[model samples]
Every structure is written in C-alpha cells, then in structure tokens.
Target: MGPETLLPNGIAHYLLGGLLIGAGTVVIYGATGITAGASTFLESTLSYVSGLPRFQQFRFTATRDWRVVFTLGIVLGGALYGLAFGEFGWTTDVQWWRLLGGGVLVGIGTRVGKGCTSGHGVCGVGSLSEASLLNVSVFVSIAVGTALTVQALGVSP
Candidate 1:
C-alpha cells in the first residue's frame, strides 16, 4: 500500500533505482575523484559561448570535459525517460517569465552557495563536508519557507 499506491512499479523499483544512482555516484567518485554537480554541467556548456566572458574566464569546459559528456547523457536519459513514461508534453500553468526568473534565481543560488542539491545533498553529505551540511541546512530552510509562503498565499496545489 505504500509505493504500490504511489507508483505502478512499486517501492522495490524505487529502491533499486536509488541504489543504482548511489552506485553510479560511487563509481564516478572512484574514477574521477570529483563530486557530480549539475550546475557545473551548465558552466561547462556555457564555457563554449564566446560572448560569455565569465564562463570563458572560469574555463569549466577545459577542466570538465567528461562532465560535459555526463551532462549530455543525463539530458538524453531524461528524454528517454519521458518517452518511456509518455509524459513528454507535461507543463506547468505558469508564465514563461516565471520559469525564466526561477531558472535565473537557481543559477545565482548555485553560484553563491557553491553547489546544488546533487553536489551538496548527495555527494557532499556522503563525504561529510561541513560546508555542504551548512548549504543543505539553508537550502531546506529556504525551501520550507517558500512552500509555506506559497501555501499561505493560496497559490499552491
């Protein structure tokens, strides 16, 4: 009645997927000695554009070559998942500007906070990084506050 009620594949499938992700993370760490971070993937991709002086300066593309491939794999895997699940056309009833603003805010937050959820929550926490712990605390706090504010404003689902 738990995951069976929530998903057709049930709890075992969820656990197996999580295990696979954890194992993959471990494999990545063992091979590269680097934590997986999605924002850095964006950085790597942005480093290609000649106009982006900041990305050009950072040289993420040069240092993170394999991660570019990893990021591309992630994108492709997501597309494959959407096709398999048949939810490719899903959308939120929000304005395009709202989505843009949110993306911008997330980019800013990742830069200021040093990393995003995959880096801090998964790999960093696994490594017992103090900064990651603090970052995660602030992240959860802000998320809770935002959810509460939205609920109070009666704009939540």
Candidate 2:
C-alpha cells in the first residue's frame, strides 16, 4: 500500500493498528496483569514441569493457576462486547452432533497446524511470521472449499 493509503487523518493506519493491539494488551494486563496468550500459558506449563531454569517461578505460577480466571474474564469481556454491539444471543436449537464433529475437527486442525485462528491469524500474523502466513492461507482455502462443498450438498440454512 502507498503512504497516502496508509495514512488516515494524517496518522498512519499501521500505527493505529499497533496502538489498538497495544491498547488491548494493556487492557488485558490492567484487568488481569498477566500475559493473555494461550501459547504462553502452555509453554509456561511445560517449562514448569520440564524443570527449565530459564522459566521463572512467578511466570509459571501466574500462568498455570490464573489462566482459568483469565480465560473466564476473556469470555465475559467478549460477551459484554457482543452485547454492546447487539450481537449477543442465545440459541436453544443447536445440533449437538454437528457441534461435536465441528469441535473435533477444530481440535485436530489446531493440533496439526500448531495453533488456532487467534494464535495464527491474530498474534502470528501481527508478528509477521511465515508459518502463520502459510497456516492462514491453508485455513482460508480449506474454509472456502468446505463452504463450497456444503453448498453443493444442499445443506439447509
């Protein structure tokens, strides 16, 4: 993109994006005062068990025990945000079998790809990682193909 396109009201869009991400991180930290990434939590847990000297004790404790509370806050925050945006709703007619299958597929895909959409699409892409780029490309392509397949199968909306 050109400089002109990148600039919004005399401020760079990239700068704004960075500021927004930084603000989110700060908000999470202010609310919980801990890093809020799943990968970091997993790594910290592994390090705690593996007897890694480089892994600080406080980091391990902060991640392992408090992650549940942190995650709950994230969910609550998302729900509140959705409500504010008028996107909050309750669905009582969900297909449990389909949901189970979809969950299994997502779990397997996350394992195979080494990350979920938040990890790869948000964090990885933001950090300009090549693996994230490839993973996202595969994910997008597969998603499109799946949508096409489902449509072809005449699935009801």
Q: Pick the candidate with the highest TM-score.
A: 1
Residue-level lDDT tens digits of model 1 in 30-51: 8877787777877777777756
| Model 1 worst lDDT window (10 residues) | 55-64
Q: What lDDT would candidate 2 get against the real structure?
A: 0.70
How do all models score by TM-score?
Answer: 0.80, 0.59
For residues 36-144, write the lDDT of model 2, one tens digit per residue: 3554455555665677666556666556666655556668876886887687766546477887898778777876888777667776776688999999999999999
Residue pairs with backbone overlap in model 2: none
List clashing residue pairs in candidate 1: none
Query: What residue runs in model 2 are displaced by over 4 Å at the alpha carbon?
Result: 1-62, 82-87, 91-94
Cα displacement (Å) at residue 101, model 1: 1.3
Scored by lDDT, the top model is 1
